[model samples]
Target: MLLSSLYIIGITAEAMTGALSAGRRKMDWFGVMLVASATAIGGGTVRDILLGHYPLGWVKHPEYLVITCIAGILTTGIAKWVIKFKGVFIRLDALGLIVFSIIGTRIALEMGLHPVICVVSALITGVFGGLLRDLMCRQTPLVLHEELYASISALSSILYLSLLNGDVTQTYATVITLTVGYLLRMAAVRFKWRLPNFHLESETSAH
Candidate 1:
């Protein structure tokens, strides 16, 4: 249940960030709610569908849905406040990335899935929500081009799986993972760490 509590925090943080994105485009309240919900829960939904892990999060936990919507509406009133605290949202987003991955990894383990699938589940749960937000907003998906976004998610899977394998208690492991993941992600952002990008400047560059 510790993970569940952290999950709530993660989604609330994510929803605020999503609402800010919606406000950037001058969207209505309805649009804000829609984007907020998507950014908060969309990744988990996609992971559930991929793994056939039925009874999606928002459906089973309607309170979480309500929380996200309320977070969205509140963002509309405090848009300037949200923008001013953008750094805080980035930290929250990093925290959410790990929490979502850990939660996904646990579910996959419960389903008797392979470690590889568990990692995949973590990846899906971490980044698909942002992907959905970008698509809905008609903006380029940041996950695809940003500094170690999905890589951080995928890497957290390794730490989580390793911890579980080491006979660590789930609660302790979750906390440790959260601390390490949050630090790692924030470091990456602060350092501008990124993957090597591929670009083709020529029309006939490759075979």
Candidate 2:
């Protein structure tokens, strides 16, 4: 079930990014599909390598690629109609992040990894794919920008791991984690919330 959910979220996010980029960059259908597939699978591929999982999740399951391609094609068509609803894309992107974080953490825990590593891995698995996608398209990565972004994913992974350790049902824990992450992200977006920035002072600052 977890894997299925991850696959769905990955495909959707890839398609959405592709479609959005298509609209924004005036890319053709094939270009959009290529970008979408990369956006969807890049992080998972990295995660599998870091986790030392052979065959990789997506490689072992070719259906994920097919789904991503189909999603890209469908989203390309739908994006034209949905372009006016800008907020919808942000919400969907948040949802994808939430789902990916939960799935990544769960997989790490199942592999008997430490909580800290699991949390970090979860964040990487959730955000790096989108970061890679944005970089490839010459856009600023959202995870590095003025929003909670990766912090929310890290928080969700930590919270979910805590709940799991406390004997919570897997389903309940996942749902709660995803909800908390999504809400936190949406709130951050709506309220323009961001982490504090620090500036260093010069030794001779005061004259």
Candidate 3:
């Protein structure tokens, strides 16, 4: 029940962010919905396709799609507020990342996947939606940029799996993972902690 509620919140937050991106591009309503839906569920769709999981989440639960669409349209009316309180959005996004990661890990575990595959699934679920949102908006994918986004997802999944392996209760494990994951992401953002970049300078021609 907790996971389900968090999943809804995660999708709604993601949809709003996607809508904001579309607004920046001056896209139409249809474009807003498209980007919003992609940002909210694109990761799960990709993960299901790769894992050969039948009936994608949004497909099975059409209400999820409706929620994202509604959230996107609503965002259009409150874009200013969203932009004005960017920090709140960032925190929400961080929470969503952890929620998505936990969902992905649980699904893979139910499928009897290897731990490594489970981690990969979590990473894809947590990061791919934002990647799609950025790509559709003609922006660089945040996953490819200097951020600990994907790493945090993987770490959260690993922690969740580890707790389960240690014989922790599902509820407890989830709570612990969510708390740690959210803090890690927020700390990364606050400290500008990120993976190193590889910058190749242009060769200067000898005059």
Candidate 4:
């Protein structure tokens, strides 16, 4: 369920970007469709291999690729309108991160991974795919920026694990962890919250 939802969000983000490109790049419909598919499935492909899942998720289900292509084609016509909604991508991205993180952690735990490994897997599931998409688009990933993006995912995964260990209800634990992660991301965006950079300039004195 989590993978499916994230896949949709990834495709949507790709389609939205491709659609809004103003046709200056001369990409035809097929090119746009290919880009969308790459963006949506790139990260999950890596995760599935790490988890030892054969054939990958979207590969085993060709419908995901078809749907992503259709979405890309549709976005080409409505790209301008979609771009006008400034917060749409950011909001959806946050929600996707929350959902995917929780689901990834849960799956890891079910597979008998240690809690720390589960948290790491959750972060990978949430952010790695998007990172690959951004790199493909020749842009810096938002997660690697100063923004508290991956931090929120990491914290949420930790929270979910702690709650699970405490015997909290599975459904409630998942809901709370996702909610916390989403709200934290939203707040970070609203407040321009960021982690401090380590680089500092020092004044040099001449004798």
Task: State the C-alpha lDDT per candidate.
Answer: 0.91, 0.79, 0.94, 0.73
Error of 4 at 106 (Å): 2.1
Model 3 vs. true fold: TM = 0.96
Clashes of each: 0, 0, 0, 0
lDDT (C-alpha) at residue 44 in model 2:
70
Model 4, global lDDT: 0.73
**Model 3 worst lDDT run, 10 consecutive residues:** 198-207
Q: Against the hidden reference, what TM-scores do the models get?
A: 0.95, 0.87, 0.96, 0.82
For residue 18, what is the lDDT in candidate 1? 90
Candidate 2 lDDT over 82-199, as tens digits, reads: 6777787788888888887887787788889898889988887888888877876788886787688899889999999899889998888987887888899999999999988665
Please list all clashing residue pairs in model 1, or write none if there are none.
Answer: none
Over 14-65, each residue of candidate 1 has an lDDT whose tens digit, in order, gives: 8998998898888999999999999999999999999999999789989999
Question: Candidate 2, which segments miss by more than 4 Å at Cα?
Answer: 6-10, 198-207
Q: Lowest summed lDDT over 10 consecutive residues: which window, candidate 2? A: 2-11
Tell me the lDDT of model 2 at 202. 69
Task: Give RMSD (Å) of candidate 4 vs. truth.
Answer: 3.4
Instruction: Identify the superior model by lDDT, candidate 1 or candidate 4.
Output: 1
Residue 136, model 2: lDDT of 68
Q: Distance from true position, residue 101, model 4, in Å?
A: 0.9
